[model samples]
Target chain A: MHTTLAWIDYLIMVIYFAFVLGIGFALKRFMKTSTDFFLSGRSIPAWVAGLAFISANLGAQEVIGMAASGAKYGISTAHFYWLGAIPAMVFVGLFMMPFYYGSRARSVPEYLRLRFDEKTRGLNAISFAAMTIFSSGASMYAMAKLIGVLHIFDPVVHALGLPTGYVFHLSILVSAVITLGYVYLGGLTSAIYNEVLQFFLIVAGFFPLVWLGLKNVGGWEGLIAKCPPGFGHAWKGMTNADTNPLGVEWFALAMGLGFVLSFGYWCTDFLVVQRAMAADSMTSARRTPLIAALPKMAFPFLVILPGLIAVALPTPTAVEAPTSASASVVEADALGHGLIPAKVKTDGSIERDSAGQPVLDYDLAIPKLLLHYFPAGLLGLGLTALLASFMSGMAGNITAFNTVWTFDIYQAYIKPEASDKHYLRMGHFATLFGTAISIAAAYVVASYNNIMELLQLVFAFVNAPLLGTFLLGMFWKRATANGAFFGLLSGIGAAAVHHGVSLPAGSVPGVKGAWINRGAEFVANLAGWSPRLPFHAYRNEMAQNFWTAIWAFGVCFVVTIVVSLATKPRPDEELKGLVYSLTKHDVEHGLPWYRKPEVLGVAVVLMSIALNVIFR
Target chain B: MNLDIRVPIGLLFLSLGGLLTGYGVVTHFTSPEIYAQSLDVNVNFWWGLAMLAFGAGMLHYGRRAVARSTAAVGAE
Candidate 1:
């Protein structure tokens, strides 16, 4: 398809990229020490950290992924934003953040060490870093693909004479490089500052698409006219097979995964956890995440609903659905039929219908809507929001990567006696290394069926094990080092086994029929040769994914707690130290009346009960 | 987070239902040709109102929370 962006639009994107780089360069002075680079020297105000944390979480992939799901899954897909994210944020704000901030740790891994043992902390840090690389890399590739589709960097691809197949990798490489350059130069301060700017734009950009799409689809009426029966219903025709909004298994999985994943992400993920750790006071840090929760409650409309509107509007004839990676958006009607639809592959090839006509790529829903519907200046602003979302997220992850590697791994293990200045330099070096690894990993990503599925798979294994170990240590005093280590390994092992075994036999619960099966006989026939196998693989992989891992977390947590009970407790001092991490009090210093363990414990329980109702 | 300026979030809700009602009235009087083309306008009026209501609800809750917190602080 021909490019939709005019030369001016291209120039605007270039200027945006340059501005981000300039911001990185400008903030270098603030990043003098390891503390400064890692956590913005722990001076970030609550609001900035709040916005940056939210911005960082809503990366390009999430915006597009949620939109794509909205197009394909309709209102049912909103559960991910509402059920999965919002509640999780509330949990983090009220419960998880207190634990994170009170611990007074540099990173989540450090918290793990205080809560569990040295071995678990080190292992979790490494696992988390690796997981971040996969997630951040996928996000980079997705963002790059979107930019390429929008023609922001199409000329560079043409000039390089690279195959269209390489565009995904090229996109990942460019995004990662830019992200790394800024993060390496400045670190968390630049990331947070830039995020605050990006958040407003991202919200503003969404309005035009939604307004226009609503207008074009004949307003809300036109959308309703175009939609199939029960399409607009938030439940999307899901019933007893799913007792709740999601099926029983899915609900269990959603809640279970929601519990484990949210706790892990809010409590342990360095990218977010470090934000709270950077606060000026324990209360500010504890409250920042909750303050951020307000935004989480409403973000899905700005990001996801536009794609749903895209489904109501006419599909663009110009673009074709690329592979699963390329097709982040889909038609709401086609998706309701339970068919994934023929999308553009990474190779930029299209499949044909029964009459041999080319299929429309559903992923172009948002872009096509933007091109045809949006006016000139608004278009540029919208694109900026998109770009900002990508950059802020990638930048934050990259900074977190550098901080964890430099402090937790390099300074702690590789060069224990390194000076602060030397370690700060090492932090910069690690940012470069992380970028390189992510770019390399992006190449293998194309072979994977679905980018989001792939991310959840890795995150499940990485997060579940760590979440189990930490939960045990925090709540159960009897949890010993041996139990923590073994429990962590066992949780990961269970998830890995479930992920592996569920595939190949057609048993994965949420895996839909392949895209090839969605088209007319002609495409369906082709789906036989290349087969629906690829798309099926993606479906199966995502089926029972995070939920499965949540179950694993629960099982491992129980086993560890039980096993620890049978074993002897550690010395009083050791136990007291573990307890102190949760209370943010010194061991030798007696607690004040308000700081009494019983008071805090009751507050925690009451908060959890309130959250349970709010989430439900 | 405390705010003295107050805007009734209920206005957002009134606009939602009000917009759709106005559109429905306008469409009723339009020519047949225009009416067919204007169906989308009608839908937008309705859904937009829904959105307006939701947004208004959020504003109301936010305002209430702020008020309560402020009251607590004042009492203290």
Candidate 2:
């Protein structure tokens, strides 16, 4: 039977969206000033902020992408969620939040200003805003594509009699319109409430699916009976670069870059920090990110379990013959072994595709599993959860984008003295504008090979530098303003050049004519670039995340300190403010770094090591 | 604000969430057969209904707590 969604499902979704809109209208009374719109009048409790933070980050890319990764890479891919993120989040909660909240800075970029100067803050803010817009667009497009696959909006598409692919675009536009409406009305408050709802729905959706998937695989023993080689294990012991599933050296590179990537996204990404900064009090703000941290630790099971279970089922009859090397591996296992691996004999062999390109289709694994398993009414809730994730993320990004533009860019630059009413209006307008830009960008980026890989590449270019700027601001006292500005720019510029020129897949050095060209191609959608390099290549996109982050922070810290020392400290008043001393001093008589940093540091190191071992 | 009640209760919820998750995972890995049959429609529906109820309850509880805290602060 066709997976037809009944009317009740639609009603449930409508009610859900209506509730979100209700929250927006409810919060409207509080939006007397721009501060309320942007920061929720700083009245959010730790628990709410915490839930919202997790929900915001656990968006479309995460739900679909994490599931996909599990299908492709096996359970070891859980490293991306659990090992890579938990430490960074804990670090942010324990150490970074105090400084960020204490600084009384509006945006993450604003903290850069207090720690350094305006120029640094302005540059970092612009970069972060750009990154958020691009990432948000990519997420929105992916979500639409997923919903279209589920045939959720077929009635609308059929009425219009549009092309098959047209439904995807339409779904995205519909989502954009609804998300933009809520964000524009309630700002951060609306986004937070929506996210909390979305998080619960997501959990409810996935937990049941995991249950169904495991049951299909004949319980744990049956699943273990079907376990392909490299199934439970982190690293398959092959050393050859071509033969290695995830690559021999990539373990280090992935773990290192993963740390850098997580720290940047969780610690510094605007959509995340914007929630933290909106907490009602300092203690709440400090606790919020940490509260979110616990949920994040449990995310792997939700995202990865579906993919692992997919391996146990008989292959679909309509599926095309194995084309990719990885497909061959799956095929081999299915034929000879009873749902077991061909390459390795044991239960836990490093799960990799046959040709060594990490499994790209794993992102599709979770959704495909849902299609295979969940029937009818329950399926509607599952689909709703997925949609909820996408909307929550888009809402979070749009809300943050609006705040940054209105406060940091528009007000700081164009309309400084605008009243609260004018600012709120501008905030709504900014949300609309941001959504429009993101939609356009999403249309361009979605066609490239793997959504998960593309996300990593984007993070490398955009977030690496932000991480650098934030790191220097937090730890290094000597960092100078000019140093930070120059360092930040140089780091991004360098990463682009590294990605663009040096690191395309299979490129030959010095033999330039008709050489292999594989790297991220943002400009391809434009008139100039598509024919020559129509899509961005993964370059076996090794851990540029780790190095770029170092360069960004290293350069900025050195530059900021050298420049500040050489020029002069920004008159003692600005330098000696409570913000500057916040990280260094514990006015509230809390535990200081010399005493408590050990536990946090040890935990971070242990997490990094565990991730490394898994990758290995 | 007096955080002793809030802090412990919050921690309890967090811990329980973690414990349930861990138990769910172990059950998933150890016994897949239990989950595969058409999801127990009764169980699934009831669980959803229960969560919906719980979520609504939490919303009410949170509102009351918030209101009471605000009043207490005002009185002081």
- Mind giving the per-residue lDDT tens digits that candidate 1 earns over A1-616? 2244444345445655775677677778667788888888888767767778888877755677667656654555555555555556555555565566765677877777776678877887788788777767777777766666555455667779976546666767666777777777778877776776567557755775686667666765677677544445554333343333333344444555456665666655788777777776665575567667667656756766676676665443313443332333333223322222345444545545456654544455466555545433335546766777887777777877877787778766789996889988888788888878877665545543345555666667777667777666766677888788778788887776555434422333233222233333346576674434332232333345655567568767877887787777776566543553434443323547554433443454455445444433
RMSD of each: 10.4, 8.4
User: Model 2: per-residue lDDT, tens digit, A1-616?
Assistant: 1345655456556655666676666666666778888998898888789889989888767887766556555666666665567777778877788788877888877777777777877877787788778878988888776666445567767779886568888888888888888787777877887787677778877887787767767876676466565656554543343443343344444444556677778898878988989999877787787777667766877787676777767664325323432444344344422222233222424334546633233445665566555554455567777888889888888887888888778887888897889988998889889999999988877444356667776776777766766776666555567767777777677666555444335433222112223323334445366554433333254433344444554454455556656754444455543233433555435756533533544655566566557544
lDDT (Cα, 0-100) at A346 in candidate 1: 44
Q: List lDDT for all candidates, in order.
A: 0.61, 0.65
Clashes of 2: 23
Q: TM-score, B chain, candidate 1? A: 0.52
DockQ of predictions, in order shown? 0.04, 0.13
In candidate 1 chain B, what residue range of length 10 has the lowest lDDT sum?
B1-10
Instruction: Give me the runs in candidate 1 sitting further than 4 Å from their true place.
Output: A149-152, A156-170, A218-225, A228-231, A235-239, A242-250, A316-341, A346-363, A448-450, A504-542, A575-616, B1-76
